[model samples]
Target: MTTQQAETDDSDGAHEERPAAIETIRSRRSGHNFDAEAELDDETLEELIRDAALAPSSYNLQPWEFVSVQDDNALDEIVELAYGQEHIAEAGTAILVVGHSEPETADEVFQQWADAGRMDEAAAEETKATAVGMYDDDRMGRDYGIRNPSLAAQNLLLSAHARGLTATPMIGFDHDGLAEFLDLPEDKIPVMLVAVGPSGGEEPERLPRRDVDEILHRESY
Candidate 1:
């Protein structure tokens, strides 16, 4: 096993040894059933979304877009698309995670980071201009959406877990049907569904990780 993998295994055991960050990691688990009595307040959901949006992307392309299905009609609609997952309908929030490669509002992507003070006007404008340059570049344009969007989804899931809520990242739905149901234009591809709500059970089990030896390499694959 590689050092990182060893550390991960040790960390699993180390949760009992360490109490701060490890504890948070240990404490956060995917919630299956949730408390229907409590719903996600708007502010908290926005905060969770803000944290999730901090996820990194290639060239700052930031291709993730979410459709928050909070209304009963939408929830019912998503349940059918999600292959009839019961928790998906019951969860307080369901984010239809989409990978949008060519957004009509690319400026908004950089504008967000700048609005958060992560970049100044000069830097944001520079970045935004540079972003436009690569719009037609196949390597950066098309694939950036796929690569960055998946990472952002992970960020959203982890952030949701950190906020004392449970989340399930599901791709077991009908993608084409979902796209049709959402009435998305060509720019949007429904990649996954994230269901979030209060935990109604014990900490869920972690899926076993492949050893680092298998996943990592020093120079070449």
Candidate 2:
């Protein structure tokens, strides 16, 4: 990803700098209008997914998976599945953020932690056992599955924005149809779909946000 230079205001003879990460978050807009001709190459998409995978997860299980749809035929099918949201086709690439409903990676993750000296062998094994036990309940496993992947989805949007690309997160698709199309295993659940590409026309104004006082709660809601 390219680094964005901080903006300076010479008119006031003052220098005000903001972190690129903050700037990317503040400037990101959900855009559906995209340049159909503009293409997102494989390398760039892979980088974005890598950044997204850095999002934190419960027990660090990192149960998220991504399905990238870039082929013309696949995009067309996605548009249909999404109830004819043409932007899925226009963007030229759509990422399906999926979550695994089982802590299948716990063994490998804890083993690595022990090997890296982050945890003693006993402690790592104990922690892994606890995590596995908690997720053994079907409801808890499903909740964590969806929750963690949603975090990755947000990171993906920010990653795309940081790279000077436009992205729109959508959840309007038919879940069963998407699952069938992707041929996902029963343990995997579709969480969100994000369309990523360059803007085609003038971007709409940023919508108003709720005031901090209205949304923020102190110790309790």
Candidate 3:
């Protein structure tokens, strides 16, 4: 979509400015309250989801699925499922992002990696063979379920930002209720809810962040 940006002090401050990627990172904020009237176009929405699909996941499983709420009546119904998160109602659209690790998806992805020459052939074959084979093995089963989908969600958020759209990553919603509302199959697990729309007022104030020195360590904390 439209790349036209109303210039701002933080963005126009310096000529030798931060790289776009770094700038996007520094400026990104979690938008909660938004103008419900500001809508996104179909072309822009498609690009946003495509960019999200670029995120990396364990085994390239890409286990995430999304239901984009378009109908006003449907959005109102889904908002109720989220326990009346006002933002969900206020947003132009809310995406029900679900995580599912069906053996079939994992198998399909693993095979693609092998065929694409990105992964070692023998290793891919072995991973493919053992992937679903290990589904019942206890150790790997639980691990893959979380690892693949979390990466996918992160990709979605960043893509939303890059597209000039803002989003909220919400864990506060009721998952079981949302699944029933969306009629999601039992195989798909709801992980997170994302509300996508345009700016409401000012961009959200940046919350405080921990310094790397405090959060990370060279070898030990």
Judging by TM-score against the true structure, name the best candidate.
2
Candidate 2 local distance difference test against the native: 0.90
The sequence of per-residue lDDT tens digits that candidate 1 reaches over residues 53-132 is 78887655667788787887788888888878888767868987787667456677678878999999889889877777
In candidate 1, which residue pairs get closer than 3 Å at backbone N, Cα or C atoms, i.e. clash?
Answer: none
- lDDT, candidate 2, 12-111, per-residue tens: 7554566777668767889888999999988999999999999999878999999999999999999999999998999999999999899999998999
- CA displacement after TM-score superposition, residue 219 of candidate 2 (Å): 2.3
User: So what's the TM-score on candidate 3?
Assistant: 0.83
Instruction: Name the weakest run of 10 consecutive residues (lDDT summed) in model 2.
Output: 1-10
- lDDT tens digits, residues 183-213, model 3? 8888777777888887687765676678766
Each prediction's TM-score versus the true structure: 0.75, 0.92, 0.83
* Candidate 2's TM-score: 0.92
Error of 3 at 197 (Å): 1.0
Residue 78 in candidate 1, Cα distance off native in Å: 1.1
Off by over 4 Å in 3: 1-16, 118-123, 137-143
Best-to-worst TM-score order: 2, 3, 1
**Best lDDT among the predictions, by candidate number:** 2
